[model samples]
Target: MEKNDKFPTRKDMTYWIIILILFMVGSFTVYYGSNKDMVSHIGFGGTIVSILLAVIAIIYSFYQSSTYESTTYKLDTSAQKIEEATKQLSDVSEIKTVLESFKGEVKEINESIIDLKGISNNIGNGVNSMKESFENTKTTFFESFNPISPKHVEVDEIDFSTNYFIKMLDNGGNFPLFTLALANQAHINKISKVNLRQYNKIYMKFLMGGKQADLGKDIHEAFRNIQFGMLSAYKSSRFVDIDFVEDDFIQINDINENLSQAIVHKVESLNDEQDGDKPLYDFLLTMKNKLSWDEE
Candidate 1:
């Protein structure tokens, strides 16, 4: 058994014992007084006094005993209830403290989650902005120069560096100008065969295709006009073509030496120019005109 249940309170037991002792003492006193023979001369008065005293003693003893027992029992029960209530109150206090701490932690975590969501949204928007910039730059470059190979096919990725150089020149990105110049030194090479007749012919055909909104003339006359334009455009230049059955180091060197210098000079001039602040949609519209379809 628990220690609390085993030990009864001493006050309750002592109160009952005192009431019992009082009853015994009162009973003995009344009996002895009533039986005394010497009180015969005062006969009736003595008997009446004795009987009254005895009755009084009995009533007082019974009342005291009942009161002590009832009071003690009630006090003991009340004290036990009070102790239980105190313990329950303590438990409730501890639970409330823990709950408050947990609530604070939860609030902090919720704030962090909100912050992370905001950061994620910002990053997503940044990536989209970069993608748009790249696309716009790409469209601008393709519009200015359409690169077709000698066979009239698009150049492969192996020539991407050369293509990048040409596009940057058209759009005024000046950084690569010096490098292109160095690559074009003629003393470094000679005896090279220069060949670009087919590409020139195609460019001429495209320019005088009679698709101009305002220009109106005979179709064959347009072709004649294009021939004259080409002569004037390249009047100071001369070109000769020679095919090599095998790899020729001298020819390759000559080709690079002749073409790289002039292109680099022209590219550097364009690079010094500034980029226009035109809206992207407007730029897109202009670039799209070079293609066959509409801007949509």
Candidate 2:
């Protein structure tokens, strides 16, 4: 029932000791009876018996001491092992705590990173919204000035589509006039006039809303400005001039081809004839001279 009663105790050693002494006595009786003559030598027998007892006692004492030492060594070794095991357990506990702390920190960092990513996404969305609004504003601006063109636009870079639009605008709302102006040099002097007339005609038709509703007085002002600008440009010194025999003009049906060559020749001749003291050069020289005088 009780733990101590269940198992034997050190009190059981008394019974073992009594049994060992009884066994020793029995063994001595048998040995002495078997050696009666040995026992008859009185002094020698006593001496021999005493020596044998003393040797047995010494051997037993040595055996007991060795056994006690071995037992003590086993107990000490077990205690040391237990102490080391306890220290190892404590170290394992500390390591586990540190690992748990690291895990919590990592979790928090992961959460923070997720929040940052969400904030980035929100910022991206805001930027996209702003971009959309700006695009809508641009479209609205273009639509507002649909019929009439603007004078100038400022941009960081120029692209082909924008250049084309600028060319169209410069040509007084006549897209065809821009095309005609870039034609071969022959036509630039001769047929360019006819092409320019054609460009005006096209522009007029387009202004009348291209066979749809008549734009009427709405585009009248713009048309007037375009006609004035075009006429002014046509009469200006910028337009090419040709002087050829009347017969030659009648002979060539292809005005552009011949006039292109003539224009190239005229350009080369003008370059060659150019003097440093020409009025245009003199005007530029006058500006430089004024600048120098001012500096002085």
Candidate 3:
């Protein structure tokens, strides 16, 4: 749009032209007749010209006013359109901002998904590694002490380890194995010093899985023969009932079996390639599973 001052009004020009025509009409009047009855008039051409001049001036004024009003209405309409266009632009900008924010949120979500996938892959790899390790170590684990693989007895009649072991099983005065079991650690260490390693390997293999929870007063009567050395000291010991039920020994036996199995597995794994512990490993371990002393 051009400046507001540039619009044409034509009011001043119309007024001046009307005034000029009126002056010319006044100056052209003709007078005739006696003084008392005299009248003033303009000739026909002058009268016609004057009326036509006045009509033209009025028509020009009406046309100018109409044109000016039309221009003002058009300018007002244009201004309204410009204001609407500006508002639309602002709305579009706001929409663009909202879309940009949504896009950013979507990007963040995708990144989070990517991170989760990476974590999932790492977890998968770790699980696979653990599975492979377990597979590699599976054979070293033991089953029941009944022996899955039969091993040869290493000791013949002259084997020193065997003779020494038989001596440990012997308790003084015919109560043999029972007395040796409760001997102090020092006596046991001294007696087995010559072939201690072989004896220990033998003992551990047999008793590996046969450990029992201390039932304290619970199993006293069943194995009270174990306290025979000190039984004479307690005057009431002889009078105590020695009776036992089958169930009382069941739990102790089961625990021993589980421990023995675990020990076998560990030993087998350690000596898998060496084969040093193979000879009496199974025989002693299975023999120790005989929990009932009276059954023999």
Candidate 4:
């Protein structure tokens, strides 16, 4: 009812009918006038040949249609495969992009770790330096308060008379007549007990108070002259009496005690005043402590 679009139109059908009628009439006339005689000569063989050619033309048309259909199907399948391969390539590219991003992140994290390690090393070094400084400060602080111990020497090896005699001569003191008498060993041996007692009394007094600065210069010089004479006499006599010289004078304990008492008196006199001799006083106290002298 919709005019059946696949069929030929009325005008085309009418045209084709007229052309068919004309072809049939023309063909009949040509066959009757010319081919009728020829057909009588050739008989049915010519008619059979025409029918075989028509059958071959129909078979060739069918083969061409089938080949066209197969080629179209193959082309469609190839296009589908190409589309799928393109999609897979796109997915691989995306994966590569993700991996590159991840690698960059990992590199950043490694760099941060290295930076942290450097900071940690710096902090460790600072702490160690602080500890060393503290230890040095502590050592210096303790040493400031602690006193150093002194070295002791043997007293018996020292020649007290000779040492005193040299100090006296160096001070420009004069020798006495008793020293000249004692220079002769025979006169020294012949010295009487009464004379020895008087000599001992004078020498003991000189040793006890001779070195005092409070004594007048004349008295000090007189005491030094007498000390020089007495020391020269003792040395020339060659007396090895430890009590007379070495133990009484040159022993560190006896000398430290005597010097300590003198320093104490000097320090007391400088109380509430400028202490010019404070260093000397401290030195004597240290020496006395080292000698283990009893404090007076």
Among these predictions, the greatest TM-score belongs to 2
Candidate 4 residue pairs in clash (backbone atoms < 3 Å): none
lDDT of 4 at 204: 29
Clashes of 4: 0
Worst 10 residues of 3 by lDDT: 247-256
For candidate 3, the TM-score is 0.31
Better of 1 and 3 by TM-score: 3
TM-scores of the candidates in the order shown: 0.30, 0.32, 0.31, 0.28
Clashes of 1: 0
Alpha carbon lDDT at 129, candidate 3: 50
Worst 10-residue lDDT window, candidate 2: 244-253
Clashes of each: 0, 4, 6, 0
- Stretches off by above 4 angstroms in model 2 are 1-44, 133-296
Q: Cα RMSD (Å) per model?
A: 23.0, 22.0, 21.0, 29.2
> Which 10-residue span in candidate 4 carries the lowest summed lDDT?
247-256
Show pairs that collide, candidate 3.
171-176, 208-260, 209-256, 209-259, 209-260, 210-256
Per-residue alpha-carbon lDDT of candidate 4 for residues 173-225, written as tens digits (9 for 90 to 100): 11222222222211223322112333333332333332211333444344344
Name the weakest run of 10 consecutive residues (lDDT summed) in model 1. 173-182
CA lDDT, every prediction? Answer: 0.43, 0.46, 0.40, 0.43
Candidate 4 or 3, higher TM-score: 3
